[model samples]
Target chain A: MQVHELRLPLRAEDIRKLKEGDKVLLSGIIYTARDQAHKKLIELIEKGVDLPFKLRETAIFYCGPSPKAEGKVCGAIGPTTSSRMDGLTLPLLQQGLKVIIGKGERSAECERQIREHGAVYLTAIGGISAVLARTIVSCETYLWEELGAEAVYRMELDRLPCYVGIVGD
Target chain B: MRYLKAEDIQKALTQAICQISYESDPKAVERMRTAHEQSNHELERDVLGAILENNELAAIDNIPLCQDTGCTVIIAEMGRELVIEGATLQEIADRAAAEAQGKCPLRASISYDPLFRRKNSGNNSPAIVHIRQVEGKRLKLKIAQKGGGAENMSFLMMLSPATPLEKIKEQIVQRIVESGSRACPPLVVGIGIGGNFERCALLAKEALFEELGRKHPDEHYAALEQEILSMINKCGKGAQGMGGGLTALAVHVLHEACHIASLPIAVNLQCHAHRHVDIEL
Candidate 1:
């Protein structure tokens, strides 16, 4: 149970070193998405449209935070179940996505894809959303506001806590 | 005949929603504290401690307990002699939920339609309300915020009258094991036994609102609850499915007599957050 503090946009080598059950304190910028946002991103990829952000050395967090209160960075931002997004995992990994942060176990296919792509899956404690929100320094909706909280957001996180659930190849 | 103001009911419900969202129920907190103290695994202890701290932050900061504020489910036990002025109970519940959504700013998780138009309702309204007639003049309300993660893990099983209770127990344990970290443990397992399909499911969900550590009134059912709780904890999935000694804090079973030939069971999983509140008017 070693603790590793890593900045985002991590290289493949960086992700491959992570093993299941290891603790991580992730800082730097990450993108937030859920089922809807994942669908949209995949649609864009199929249509040959440019993505909103670069996928290289990047991680996508599965979350839909509550509305923020005054003077708060974000509201109760925690991970959603990752299995729901398993269908999209391989496609996103193929596009150079390096890490996925969420709760729950990934499907076998998703895990295989992660290992092949040298990516990792991490789990944030579910239901402790308010405590997790304290680590997020800032957030801005980057795409799909019409989806409400399901919209993709660019979040600047400082020491966001997570546990490695799957290690890369 | 006693009369209750619809506005008063609405006001009470709105306040209840806010309280349930922000303050972890005292019984739930107590169970978490006990689990934290008794857990043999360090990871399980840490997870319980973090959950307890999150509850404190939510209460002090006046924010939601979980990111998924969940769809509002309201159960109202209305007295036969009581008359609600100004609005129907369903109307009052919906308005109250909407009001709470605005004030507490609960995440709007409801989609108006199930299929084609998956649009956010925005107000978290059109709450799922169930009304039952009781004997007295008091109006009793139990509200719970049912999050998608655990709600999605709910299961329904139909068995023959000859099916043994052991088989039923196996099914219940299987559901929890399959849910793993997805539903977020330590969970409160709510089991509904011996009702029609839909009624059975509702019973399971209603069972979740029972106070933690409270047993079923029936001795047989109470023992069954204890048996199931121990079996689930042994599965070794632990807190957050990270592998530990405490997978479930408690198991609650609610049963009603059904047709002689039918046996149906439903399991509703509730996460450690356990967001529910009760009010009487």
Candidate 2:
């Protein structure tokens, strides 16, 4: 598998270079969202309400942050199973979410959406959470703070590693 | 009558919960290491290695091996001869689990209500505890921090007793194929056969507590385990579904006698990080 180092808010055009099985170490800002956050975001989009953050040219990590240990920026952060959010992905992709990082496979419809919408799906190692957590440079609640761990977390990543699970055509 | 203090049981459960969150279960680690060493494929090999490395890191740093601290499951075999002093076993277990979850920095994975509120319980209390009365004076408990990903993929089926061995094999293989990487491969497949519906499901979960790579005592069941393991590996859904050798580390079959016309089967998948502890008091 090929290895690539790309910084995030990855441009849609740059995603084409990443094919399935390629490895990537991403460094930059990405937002965290699990199924709950996805639902809320979709509801906001459906109501024509402006989201607090822009979705275009952005990397969204499927994750829920634990309460941070005393000095660490985050705690035990890792990819949740991505297929849980499969149905909610299309609208975000349409809004120009360029990179989606999670663990495990996606549904056929989710795959088709990524292929058509100029987005890529990246898979991180499931359960190897602490190693992944160390890559977080900083983390803060970006939205839906009342949702606790399910809230959207704005994080700066320093060489977060993952494999390409699907590619945008 | 031998006296077993309620406080002692609570203490044991609390320590076991905190211990498993960081320390790697020895047998599971051994099998994972073996899979890592034996794999010929690069990506599969690397994924296995990363899992092993993460175990070491989690232990050293005193952090959870996985972010999902998991819903607590405890199976306690209570000795009939033993008398408890302070509280019921279930109440003690609940309190112990809550204490560990709140103190150890483990995530609160349990929702207070499954449907309506979906509010986090915050302390991960009210463990799924199964208590059985036994003859001995000593108490034994198996505690598992079962994560949502693997638990969600577990299944059960009521097959016609007429269904043969090959068909049963087919059903199990198909289930794993559907699970793919979502259940997190390099899994431990626990098969519970011949019991009634609920009993079968509980048997499957109990089977997961078996040591990885240990063969069943009954020769016939041992053979069944081997056959299923081969079929899963042959499906080519490798570590994390990358397509290679060793999709599952082992398959464990635990069976009990059932009615003449009924055959029930259940499959419980435990992911690479098998976090559980056995306690004797």
Clashes of each: 1, 0
Report how closely model 1 matches the true complex, as a DockQ value: 0.83
Tens-place lDDT per residue, model 2, B1-281, is 99878888898889999899887678878877887888888898878888888898887766688888888999889889988889988889889989888777788777889999998787888799998899979789999999899999899999999998899899989998789888888899988998798999999999999987898999999999999999999999998888788789889999999989899999999988889988999
For candidate 2, chain B by itself scores a TM value of 0.97
Top DockQ: which candidate number?
1
Q: Rate the local accuracy (lDDT) of all candidates.
A: 0.87, 0.87
Cα deviation of B159, candidate 2, in Å: 0.3
Tell me the RMSD of model 2 versus the true structure.
Answer: 1.3
What candidate 1 gets wrong by more than 4 Å, as runs, is none
How far out, in Å, is residue A45 in model 1? 0.9
How many clashing pairs in candidate 1? 1
Report how far residue A98 has shifted in candidate 1, in Å.
Answer: 0.5
